[model samples]
Target: MEQWKKNLVVLWFGQFLVMAGMTMIIPFLSLYLQFDLGLTDQHEIGIWAGIIFAGNFVTSFIFQPIWGRLADRYGRKMMLLRSGFGMAVVMALMGFATTPWHLLLLRMLNGTISGFNPASIALISSTTPKNRMGFAMGTIQSGGIAGTILGPFIGGLLADTIGFRPIFYLTGAFLFAASLLALFIVKEPFDRAKAAAREQVSVLQGFRQLSGIRELTALFAVTFLIQFAMMSPMTLIPLYVQELHGTTENLAFFAGFVGSVTGLSNLVASPLLGRLSDRIGAERVLGCALLGAALAFIPQALAGTVWQLLAARFLLGVFLGGLIPAVNALIRKYTPDGMESRAYSFNTSTLSLGNMIGPITGGALSGWIGIQGLFILSGVLLLANAAWVWQSLLRKRPVRSKA
Candidate 1:
């Protein structure tokens, strides 16, 4: 196989392992808080859960751009190794947490070290053939989705069987193995002298350089909105499913199924859509996917049955599948070659910001506006973003405006 193909194959498994470990905590988090950490109050558990979950993104949002700039100067592969190994240690330490604060501290450390996803994206983007960028990104994305689809299921099962602490150990072990695999399998043909010869700037200077590019900045905002719109209603999904099902028995099972179905469809659809985008145009694919996602949200908002919601969620996944890779590809296109990794890192920061804000907004909005209203609001936001993409991207004109 070609070097690029070789790199993709290696990163695929690495991504899956890393992503699975990350998502594995989702199912058992509140349980762990209650059973192990001795958080007796329901209100306290809710607050801690929110804090522990958001803590990682908070630090990651602050640090990803810094990592990206470093990746541009050194190499993405180096950054990947650093993140993969560092995360492994942090994850394992979580298993030793004796208190809620311990877990919270570990979680924050995890976020500070978390750059695996964006680092891997930047590496693959820099290495892959331009013509195959979409396919590469799509396939890479599928790995993460596969982990997400499998993680909660495995975590739930493991927590029931071997207990929660061991799950973290297992997650840490998997990450270590993944990083080890990358060490031998993934290769980067980095020319650092050439990179060093280019004008180097402070991280802030680099940020200014990126912010100055109008289309890239627009693309970054679109990336943020894409994540915001998609994630906004997810925190309320289980409750929505319960509302539709109206039964506690098998409620968790049904909720898990509904959650996994979207990821399942996303995993299957991403590479296929990416291939299609490569043949046609990533912008068009992104535009269509945005519109399809906006439309798909309607069925979900109006879903009278859990099955209806599942179907809608699955369709939403299929449409939303192509959006990220398309955005990544477009970012790669618009970015200067030497600064590609930093561009991706900055985009990743926006994504982290979206991730942080979405659930908080969703959780709050569901209370004030109802679950269905949150869904509709997400749809409306996507619709507006689609229009924005249409005006900003499809017009085929440069954005000369200042940031």
Candidate 2:
């Protein structure tokens, strides 16, 4: 492999390991909070569970943009190293949690401190040429998706056999290994002349730079909506599965399968859709993906069995697979060289915010309205986004030119 490809692979695998380690907690943490710690009452369990789950994303959301700007100012490589090493230590400490509050605090701290994805992404985006940005981002994205796909299955097995705390130790050890690899294998080619050439923009200045780009601002709006649509399902689906089946047996297995299915869809669709967007345009491709995603939710709401849900999730994954890469490419197309990291950072923070909100929203909705309501609401949001984008494009084009 070429040097850049090698870097991409290492970064990808490192991220994969880190995400996998973090997500292992998801499959079993609720049970740990309820049965293990005796947090009785379904409502109380929901509240604490939501907090433990959303805590990390909320903190991560707050810090992501800050980390992004820091990456640009100092170095992407440094940020990646910091995130990896920090997460490794934090995850190890999680194994020692003796109470729900302890776990929740650690999870919150995990989010505030951890940032491997943003760091690796900043480095990758900065290094990639605009033409190949979609492919590069897709590859990096697949790593995290792959980890999600794998985490539940592995976690389920560990939870059933070895126990929850052991999984944390395993996660910590793996992350420790990943951190060492990241510190040694990944290279950030710094240009002192170029670094000096970059204007010492403040945080507000970075926001100002994004504000000037109308397309990116609109794209960021779309990104938040897209994440809101996707993340809620991720937060609720495992619980939904548990409620439906009335057992945790094979929960990880099913959840992992669902997660893997999404990755599989992305793995299959990203390159194909990306190449298609390159030929046509990202706008049209994204519009189609959004519409298809809205349609796919129908089957999910109507799912009568776990198999049906699995199938719906797999197909849903296919439709939404290329959306992020397409969106990232659009942002890259619009953003200048030095500013790419901050833009992505800001966008990711928004995504983290969406992630933080999604679970809370899903849990609340599931409590009041029902899971089906979530599908309909999320679908309506996506359809609205698609219509808005389509109409906005139409408004921007000169009718006389078409004539």
Candidate 3:
């Protein structure tokens, strides 16, 4: 097998492990706060849960570009290992937290060190053949989505069986194992001496240089909007499910299905769309996906039954699956050589920013507008974003794939 193929395979699993470990705590995060940390009030648990959940993304948004710069200067594999191992230790410490503050701080620290996913993207992007970039990005994305879909399920089960604290230790152990896998198996052909020879650019300078490109800047905004639109309705999905079902009976099961069904369909669509992007061009796929995603949201907003909402969300996933891989492929195509990591990092920063702000905004707005209204608003936002994508990307002839 080719070196790039080898790296892609290893990094795919590595991305899976990283995402799974990170999300494993999600199923019982509030439970941990209330029971283990002794937060008695439901209101207090809700507040603390919100803070703790957002904490990682808050610090991750600030630090991703810094690490991206370093990855460009040094190597992406090193950055990947650093994040994997660092997060391993921090996640383990969460198992030992004695207070809500301790858990919150640890979560923030985890965010501060989180770069494995972006680094993995940068690594695979740099190494993979340009013609296969779409497929590579899509395949790697599916791995993370697979992890995200499975993590909470496994976490929920383990929380009930082995208890919460040990799940942390188990997550940490899995992360450590993933890091070691990368250390031994993944090979990055980063030219450090050549990278060193290039004039060093500060993070701000790099950001400016990348943002100066109109398309790259537009791509960044697209990434932000994608996350923002998708994440905005995530926390409220259960309530919406309850509303649609008209009862709390089997609410957890129904909610879990609705929440994960999008990802399940997304998992199936990503690689298929990715190959299509490789043939037809990522820009076209991106624009069409955006439009399709926007249209899909309308049904979710209008659905009066749980089954209807589930079907709508699943359809939405098919388009949502195409967005990120196309964005990553386009980023690589447009980025100047030797700055790919930095470009990906900046995109990751925007992604984290959206993750951090989306839920808060969703929760805040849902009270005023209601869940159905939030869905309408999200669809409208995505329609506007689709227009932006059309103007910024599809208006230009897409770069042809190399023969």
Models ranked on TM-score: 3, 1, 2
Clashing pairs in 2: none
Off by over 4 Å in 1: 397-403
Whole-structure CA lDDT of model 3: 0.89
Q: Give me the candidate number with maximum lDDT.
A: 3
TM-score of 2: 0.85
lDDT at residue 267 of model 3 (Cα atoms): 96
Model 3 misses residue 202 by how many Å?
1.4
Tell me how far the alpha carbon of residue 400 in candidate 1 is from the true structure, in angstroms, after superposition.
Answer: 14
Better candidate by lDDT, 1 or 3? 3
TM-score of 1: 0.95
lDDT (tens digit, per residue) of candidate 1 on 1-403: 9988988988898889888887888889999999999989999998998899888889999999888888888999999999999999999999999899999999989888888888899889878998899999999999988997888778888999999999999889889988998899899989999999988887789888888876687788778887887788777788889999998989988987887888888999999999888999888998999889888889998999999998998998998788887888888877877888888889989988999998878877877898788878888888888888888777775553223
Q: For every model shown, what is its TM-score relative to the native structure?
A: 0.95, 0.85, 0.97
lDDT of each: 0.87, 0.77, 0.89
